[model samples]
Target: MPQRPLARALTALVAVLTAAVGAVAVPGAAQAAAAVNYVALGDSYSSGVGAGPYDLSTCLRSEKSYAPLWAAANRVTSFKFPACGGAVTSDVIDSQVSALSIGTTLVTITIGGNDAGFADVITSCRFGSTSSCTDAVNEAKAFATGELPGRLDRTYAAIRDRAPNARLIVLGYPRLFETGSCGLLAMSTYKRTILNEAADLLASVTAGRAAAAGATFADTRPYFAGHGVCAAAPWIRDVSGVIEAYHPNADGYRYGYLPALTAVTG
Candidate 1:
């Protein structure tokens, strides 16, 4: 062979060998390096009701929501966000799962809150009497313990079926209130304790469902410990005129949920 041609061919062969060796050394390195097709599915928290500027009037999808924040920061090739303001698990199975596919590399969900009637509890407790508050809390606790696990399991299964290859991360709700009053005139200290425990229960049940479905669970309670509605620097709104009340704010998504997603997905 001519020397120049032979030398060029040798260099090309060496490059190919190096590429093959790299792929072999780090299994799934090529797949991992591929851009992630992410789909966000769930309810108010995922839709960014409290964390607005919203994308749609109904869906309430926010660019500042933790999923979008994570997607923007990461190598996301495509994104489909179907999370709405009051979506239950059934809503996800019917409406949002269509967004998922085998091509999806990641799916993050924050449902089951609406299914357990969490919003109704907040509303009834905030405006009604102490007895009404207790009743609402008790009802929510019942739903969380009895019905939520089954609902969650179904949602997880649906997502799994739609995106078998994707990594699912089930994010849970945070405790909405702190111990002391901190000028929250709605509920008493006793009520606060009950509500907080209910939130904890929701997280626990959701975590169990996620584990059963082979999905990762992100517990958000710790992230909002000192940043509850009554905290000095509250991440959740106490009672906003807009739809922002009780949900996480822009800062909450940035500081709280963002880190949790990053830690697990990375």
Candidate 2:
């Protein structure tokens, strides 16, 4: 009952063709499922100012930042971290967007705080009288509600233009202080409340602008809720002598911002 020679030859040819087809198809499928090409861009928060042991000291790009953590965890194809310590909306439009391109499949940014004069506002609140602190907060709030929206619009638009295929994520700053006693910290409860309000306002404006630009907004407030600067297990730094003051610590990037980002990306 052995097969004829011609029949056996034809069957062997069919097997070879099937193997060749599978070889071609398998690689294509793998390419399609490959990891993303990610680019991280923005200001101090994005660059990991509060998280130490920076990989790029010029920009304060930390290996512990959410960007790097996510990149490593997900095993992305490429990761470009151009985020600096003090980038404003203008800086993103002018310099940071250069890192993006059609190949960039993911992008994350945290900006607008510097443009709102947040650092100066914090300085005023920390050192000046209650009236001065209130005035500073009011001024920053005005700018955030007024001129900051347009700037954010421009920044988001520029990013989209550069990385047309990227899923852009706009991350927000967390409320810096918890409204209570930190034994030696001089900030009043009123100051803490106003500052938190300012952060909320900034988040709202940034969220609205991000929606308009077709980008996703990731709010860090909820994640950092009980972990503000004065909390028992705080994630944000509390008036440290260095530039890291009022920013997220390493844990903040890992547990707070990282989780917020993961939720949105999923």
Candidate 3:
């Protein structure tokens, strides 16, 4: 072959090989584009307390949890699920905030329930009289209005400082029961109603704080309407069989929370 023809053939071969490599790289690049650096932070609801098959025993992170489900479905670039079973607002600051960074593109948090002593209120109501339930509910309500807002602001501000560019989604707790006869282990209808009202107050405060902090609040009450502890098919645990009672079940995370998050993100 002449020297010019030989050089042309080599150039053609290189072009063909380069095209093949480019073609092979397209899908991976697209996949990367579809993903983002996501960090999950919050409490038992975010950690999947009643939803079993935990990823970590200490944090009680379940594979079926809404955070993991959402991350997997959305195809996250990197997911750090630092949510724990009994995390309060301070817990997120002390433990979970370290997982976030300026590089994080997305974050979801479910906190403040513990800060209002929600579990203690429920426990007191469960074992004590109706008056005790009312008292607990009132106390929780006061805290939700007065103290919790500040705590939530601190947590949200910390998250903002850590992941300034990330889209933070703050998820609120669902109503724990419907207005009817609960099971024997459950609180009375009136008490359940009061507790649900308290949950509503908490959600309101949380949503307000989240908005103030430049985050979106995902209200889960509508999603959990008929699926509370007293429903025919309850999504929340009726009793304290697991580590944290009154938390969502696997079905709740799948059907209730996942859809709520999907709607918000979409």
Candidate 4:
């Protein structure tokens, strides 16, 4: 409106606009960072239960789970932490999710162990006096052989619905039995039979579902070889530190999990 001010304003505007266009024209001018939205969904394994130092309340979530590990490894920008301990197929499918950010780019999941009640099966078999967890081990075999495929399918579909565009990766459970135990007081006979079958079942089932869902399935079974119940360099070290109880140790997680992650994120 004023004569002198109008002239100065026009001059300043021209300088600002010119600078902006110059910045754009420059090659490799430090582009904006890419946004990575990762969503995690699953049970205790995914939640990293018993990983220590993390706060695990009702759902028993963990900050050190493979989900976060992969996120950190790849430098994920955004995350929806929906994973919790004891989650199952039914919970994932039926529950209303509050944490998912729309248009998420990645997701990682692991389930079905709770469904199989595999932990209980292990305990029950161990508790038996005559046989060293043989009957329970057989049941684990059945779970791997029988129930795993369907569970994987159902869980994959649910994730697809929630984040259809996201790159989904489902993880297989680690082994829990040893092939050549001393036929000891709690774990013997059909040595490691239950864990043997479980590994196979989890790998096959998740791989199949991942194919159908247009996602990736990371096979950790091979990475964990010789690390089961009686393994010398067992990837999965139990709570007891001697006998294979459940869950992969820190070494197993890094070795068994990292490859799977790089497969998808890379």
lDDT of every model, 2 decimals: 0.88, 0.92, 0.90, 0.68
lDDT of 1 by residue, 1-266 (tens): 57999999999999999999887978677676887899999998998888877884688889999988998898589988888988999999999999999999899999998898888898887888889989998998888889888988888999999999999999988899988866636577877888898898888888988999999999888887799877889898878755778899888998889888887877
The sequence of per-residue lDDT tens digits that candidate 2 reaches over residues 40-110 is: 99999999999988873688889889999999988899999999998888989888899999999999999
Model 2 alpha-carbon drift over 4 Å, by segment: 1-32
Model 4 pairs in collision: 125-133, 177-229, 178-229, 178-230, 227-234
Each model's TM-score? 0.88, 0.88, 0.86, 0.76
Badly placed stretches (over 4 Å) of model 4 are 1-32, 129-134, 137-148, 181-186, 239-245
Question: Worst ten-residue run, lDDT, model 1?
Answer: 181-190
Q: After superposition, how far is residue 255 of candidate 1 from its true place, in Å?
A: 0.5
User: Which TM-score value belongs to model 3?
Assistant: 0.86
Residue by residue across 1-266, what tens digits does model 4's lDDT show? 57999999999999999999998767544433557788888777777664534564676565666777777877778877777777888887766233454588788878777777777766665555435456665676677668766777777777777776777777777666567754345355454565566567666766787788787777776666676656777666554732225766656666676666676567
In model 1, the number of clashes is 0
| Best-first order by lDDT | 2, 3, 1, 4
Pull out the clashing pairs in model 3: none
- Of models 2 and 3, which has the larger TM-score? 2
Residue 114's lDDT in candidate 3: 86
